[model samples]
Target chain A: MTDAPDRPADAETGTDLPAGPADSDAETDPRTDGGLPAMDGAVPTRDPGAFSQLATALGRPLVVGTVLVTVVFLILPVLATFAASFAHEWAGVLPTFVRDGEFLTLVNWRQALGLTQTDLGAQRGLGGFWTVFGVPIPVTIGFSMLLALGGVVINLLVGVPIAYAVTRYDFYGRGWLNTFAVLPVVPGIILGVAFLKTYSDLPSAVGLMIGYSLLKAPYMVLAVQSSFESMDLRQLEESARSLGASWPRTFLTVVVPNAKTGIVAGAIVCWTLAAAEFNFSYIVYSSGPKPFSLFLFENISNNPFLQAAAAISVYFAIVVVVTALLQAVGQRGFALGGVR
Target chain B: MSTLDEGPLVARLRTGTEALLSPTTETDRERRRIAALALPFVALAVFGAVVPLVVMFRISVAEEYLTATAGVQFDAWVTLLASILAFVPGVGSAVDADPVYGEVIWNSLWFGAVTTVASVALGIVIAHALEKYDLPGEGLLVTLISFPISLPGIVAAFMMIVWFGKTGLLTNVFVWLGGEASLFPAVTSNEVKLTGRPSGTTIAVFGLFLGYLYSMVPRATFLLRGAYAEVNTDAEAAARALGATPWQTFRYVTLPQIRPGIVGAVILTFRTALAIFGTVLVLKALSVVTFRFDQILKVGYDLPTASALAGLFFFFTVGFTFLSLRFTSAEVTG
Candidate 1:
């Protein structure tokens, strides 16, 4: 426990070394053991020994096969959806005309986006583009983005202070504060229903924004606190104080910038999740402007195959892009990323 | 005698108070003040999240609303006790001939267990492989595997249908290969037919399973990968140097160190599967408690019953959450 202070630094430098080589140096001197090759480094040199050569030949295929199988399993659904999003017709598990030139078509895209003619003559709103809600598919997309953005802003405002205080200060009930932040995230579906029932009187949009921020802020707090805890906060603060900057100014200018990676990563995760949230949005926002998720849910059941695919593809694109950005920024401690 | 005794005691207390109240440093005072900044967030979380859940619990016990189909039951406790006892093999099934709540609970437990075991096992294997071996395209593989974590449950469920529904790509492939046309499970219950459960097919359950696995496996992998990365390879190497087999080294040296991560992944997957709603609804599976709770409110128009069901669900969820916090010392979100 006393060595905890030095561990993180050690970890930072120690990540690249394989366990085998490090162990060989300590207890069992690998060179003295039956002339067997030592697993000294990560990459094996082209050793002339038969055993070394055989080990490489045997291990290579196993690694490749495992990676290949895992990748395929993870990617199969996305590939299937991406393919179905464009195909005009389905023949069993595949498109009807993939073997020929007509395998690809834009009809589904057109119909889904409300660019095509509406099948209902009297209810003709350009292929479900215009609905009773007086909004188009594009509008819903915009609404979803706005809602997500609003949630991100609200969460950051609530999360940053808590993160700062808990990480940098010693205070009463600080432990409880951390737990409080996390409580909202535990029972997602139940909370959604609970919010609906509890705040039935509050206007739909206002209630949803509150619910979303409550749900999303914890992820931010957790991430930002981690970034703050890992930082050399006292040293930085002392330097800023010696330079005559006020504590608030130092926190705003120095502390926040240092934690920017975690903040950005947490925001991306929060925004994407808020945009894609369906249960709360479905239950709570039923009366007001429906988000893209609800719109997709409504259309998926009865809409033309092409239209459903197109709408889903658009939403999918948004979430994937934002999520990809999150991965890029902080794959270590961002999206359900490690706590410590 | 009384005055002298009181005066000395008061003087001693005053000195102690003075010593305690004196400021240590300017920065310490600043930090103490700054710590109050967390108060508002605490208040907001309490009011927004905690209060609502508490109200749900209150509604469960309170005889609040009376519906035409099902009247208000102060007997929520009775129902809860009955439901719990229903977990026994044959005794509970005889209590409720409809077998609705019992079957739903049974299905939820089974699905949660299956999903937890499968995802955790896959996570351990893949995370170990990624951490230990230098695989080609490692970056892309990690990204792809973890991609579904960000996807909405509804979208994942929609993707499942797109891939495996009646006219789905996989279904068509099965046909092309001269096999059965659908990969979906057959439904046995008629009450949820409108929810799109095919007769004799558990497709709804299967769809929900896919949605859970699609996201949970990646999440598990992400978590376990970190655990694997943090593992002290020195110990494993030491064990290996002593001529222990690879499996022995893993079981003795590696597994114990990563036990918390393994527990974290299992609990997260299980709890997420338990709380899953949008995916189950989109896929039309009503066996899970979340969907059933929602349905009781919306379709049955029985708020009290719904509240009771939610309360019971929360009971199970809270138990799992306690386990999760104990294991990982953090709250996990789906």
Candidate 2:
């Protein structure tokens, strides 16, 4: 608000209105003849204009309140869901941590992860598990992770080169190509429908991988493009070339190594998204191991509330880890891409 | 002399291919390099997107899509067009067809637009606060906000259920406050009517609206934040120094600078809204076009109608997005 700016300024200047008449006079005396005499009538006074006063009183709170409310709205459900996943009962105003005088339980988490057997018919936990070196991994989560990683691999191959080309070279139709690379040309569901008809005989994993790479290539392009834009790519390429490095060598070693952070961040984001991509997976998934997102969909629509919470919390945990990794790689939590 | 033996087009093509295969000049080498770099993306786009989309269009008019796309027919297109026409108020009585597709498409547009506007308006406020004000834990605030962007739409819907379901936090609070339980916006069941007053009717659609906002606000905020990061702070400071109130400074100076960004965010966010399927599917509050695709494909096995609807949706979105960006001064930064 109008007063919001003044209060900070007043604090920084060590001046206060209504403190004393003499001090107020001392504050205004220098301004009258200092810069603009014609604006003497508009100088600060004990009473500001009605509009300014109204704005000062309301604007800061309005903006700050919106921010606070938005943050709470966005974050509270996540926290609550996580907490409820570990709680005993959620049939009241708050999820209770005590059941039958025992405080807290991991039953929901255990059941959600397929770590324990449950009596609930039709609402099965992660249905199958694959044993790898004596360690059992949930088949749904494992398959989805591999599937999403495949997408990321393709994204790297396809996205990194286009990003480099757009940034480091000039060509006809460069703008259009850049737009296409960075903007998603097709939504996932549409692509899923297309895949269903075009590649009816293709394996689900391969189809999903290709679909994911096409759907999420934009994120990779945008992220790498940001990093490429930050560096003097032309200079780097030329320097490498002058040092007797071939163009391909320069691109693979010099250019790519320089954009490591962006590439890593892009891969992490794309993997996380593809793992939990429900719309396309929901439509195109015909057989074989269910994607993690479909498992989540099953849990959400069919299972009990607490069970659903636990299922979603599994993803929330993956995202949290991925976010941390993204931060470590020097991007601010998926900010590099305009759309997911 | 060799060029005289061939036509210009053929000669140009031969030279172009020769340049790409074995370039003898710097320009040709550079051209080859560009081609090499662009080849992978082009290949993927062609095989993954273009080819499949063409096949989908073919299927839309196929006589029998499931067994084999043996013959072409316009029956699916006719049904789709007639259904859409049936939903129009003036033309409804003449069409003599179900208006479900038309209703769903209308729902998608109106809902998408409403959510886009709300999200962008809030985005401006949030982005302005983050950029202009010195808030504590700005990094953490950003991380929390952008977290939802990583979540799929189904999770977003579940988050809504966590907040507004029958035993949800807010619904419980309202019930505890001497209010009738039925009056609250509780997403109890799919049978909950999407329309009418909340006193006797369930407000599941309101819960869905909030679900849409949950996903959209963060995306819109982040999109606008990119614009905010480039705002000329000096002008704002100068306006403030010249006795301009905060609101006045923003209204007069900041708004014009970020107008393009606002437009860009609106376009992108509206696209996000239209493409949102998982949330509507899980919530089952209103029958949007995306949900209709699920019903057509999964329940009725009506591939042609679904393909026709999807084609129309795809063209509208792609056309709207590209044309707006081309015609407007919208600055869409990644």
Candidate 3:
């Protein structure tokens, strides 16, 4: 929706209806039926042709203008963060270009990437290592992927059975269990506090895993369960049972294969959500074995703005790329459930 | 009616006779097998969700302080009740009148309500616009519009900072403009300066409104689009043919059809806004219950008090969810 200076004339096609008065007289087209008579009714009061044209001219740009502004608002942060990664003391509505007739500094990029140590405070290590299991890992992306994947695994293990049970049975507590599945909607920090207070004895990583899985389970359940609901379980299961397959065997072999797309969709969504999870991670994670979000949040204030922006952009890029992939996948099979 | 009454009873009697005849029947084994299949999920939920909530309630009621020494005593529940009642007209005052409770609760409600209304209103319009228009690159536009839903709250908070924080691009623009404005004193007032400071309550609330909108709009759009698709466009064409203005047609014909979507969006946005944590945290606005709860629990380490807040918050969630369920059920039945 950004206002491109080179906006094509055809861009206005979305808003400007063919039913405008000027085009109405040429009523050979099926879509312009109402336009001619409506213009005829209003012609005595004013020149309807000019008025409609003016309205069309005014309305289209106005809609486009609002859209452009919204787009800017939507993407300003990412753009600003990306710009700041290479900016040398950016302080304006937009980053300055051609500073002294040359490109601005890449000092922020280097500082952010841990290639060089800037004299940031001692507490703020200059893009230093994030430790996992007492071993320092230089790449935050790998660690992030691992934590997210761990959440995915945990959710699949927990969610698949829940989905199966709820979809496949008319159980006693089915209604209540279905209600309880939506426990993910409870804010992560609440669960964070709950888990921290309750499982004070357990390791932080375990707490994180449990918390994330609990939060992520609903989505996985919903995804797989919807797929199951759409399927004719009686036909599939009965057919399998008739073929001398045991219930569990039929379920594992037949049902699981049918809902494979849903499982994968759920896993991808769960992974992305876990990767983006910050509040719970912030509360649950101590110094060791940090998630990427915590990794960024910790360095936000202490590190240089550009350096911090670089780190944020890294995560932002990951989120956008993963989300785009998810969207592409969503277009094929399962709907991505909302998570905040 | 006779069959309905006697069928289950007859079956039970026959099953009893069968069970007596054969102690380990196939039906019994099959029932056990099905129950066993459902057990794992039930166990997981009980351990993960039910146990934690129970423990949370227990901790909330347990006394953080005794008369002389800290002990796992009772009376916090009484205090909690009193605090709740104190908000009532006739109830005079709370015994443990911590100002934080009043401020946090009030702020949570006020901010949550504002954000919900704003987000829902915007969502309706956006949803309508996206659907009603034959927009070019509509899919891409839809994707762009909905992309914020996938953004983590922390990232949204950071985006807020990037746009509006001190040293932010927008703030810098204001500062630079202010410098230029001084040269034209007749036009520019002293109040025109951008201080480049952290936002106050009003601005923070606005920022949160934006954040909530960012999160909720896509979801609302998704839901409403389905609702919109189901809407009878013939009715809209009829209204248009009858010379009703587009706005009038939308108000009269279209809105009623999408009321369920609107209600769903309202409930969802309200719930999310009330429970939102990261935005409030990054904005340094601890006025709301969720942030206050985190602060009290994690930072202050006042387990009893924090637990009370959490307990209250949990109740709020449950109550709203009940209301939401009621609405959905009503919509279904009626």
CA lDDT of B68 in candidate 2? 79
* Candidate 2: true contacts recovered, fraction: 0.72
lDDT of 3 by residue, B1-334 (tens): 5656678779898776666455496566555555565566566667766787777777766654322223465565666566655655455363445444666787788878887786666566666766777778777767676666656666777777676666665666556666754544453322322222344545555656666555666655555565676789999888656544455456667987877766766676677777677776766644677777667756767777766677777777878876776757312100
In candidate 3 the C-alpha lDDT for residue B314 amounts to 77
lDDT winner, 1 or 3: 1
Which portions of model 2 miss their true places by more than 4 Å?
A4-52, A118-127, B1-7, B179-202
Question: In TM-score terms, which candidate is top?
Answer: 2
Off by over 4 Å in 1: A1-67, A96-103, A117-137, A171-176, A179-185, A327-340, B1-31, B65-73, B90-99, B179-207, B327-334
User: Residue B271 lDDT in model 3?
Assistant: 76
* Residue lDDT tens for model 1, B1-334: 5655778779877754554456377754564455446666867778777798887777776765332222345676677567756766768666653456766787788888998898788788788888877777777777677667767777777767766666665555545555454333352222222224642256566656666777677777776776787789999888666544444456667987888778766776677677677777777664577778667767966666667777778777776677568757443322
What TM-score would each prediction reach against the true structure? Answer: 0.78, 0.89, 0.77
- In the range A1-340, model 1's lDDT, one tens digit per residue, is 1011122225333343334656556534645656766544333221113333343445446545765776675577676666677876765545654545665777677666655556352123222333437655545666677788888888888888888887777666776666666544546667766775688778777777777888778678877876887898889988998999987788889988999987988888788778877777776665655676777786676676656777778766776677667767855322355321
DockQ of each: 0.30, 0.47, 0.23
Question: TM-score order of candidates, best first?
Answer: 2, 1, 3
> Would you list the rank order by DockQ, best first?
2, 1, 3
lDDT value for candidate 2? 0.85
> A-chain TM-score in candidate 2?
0.84
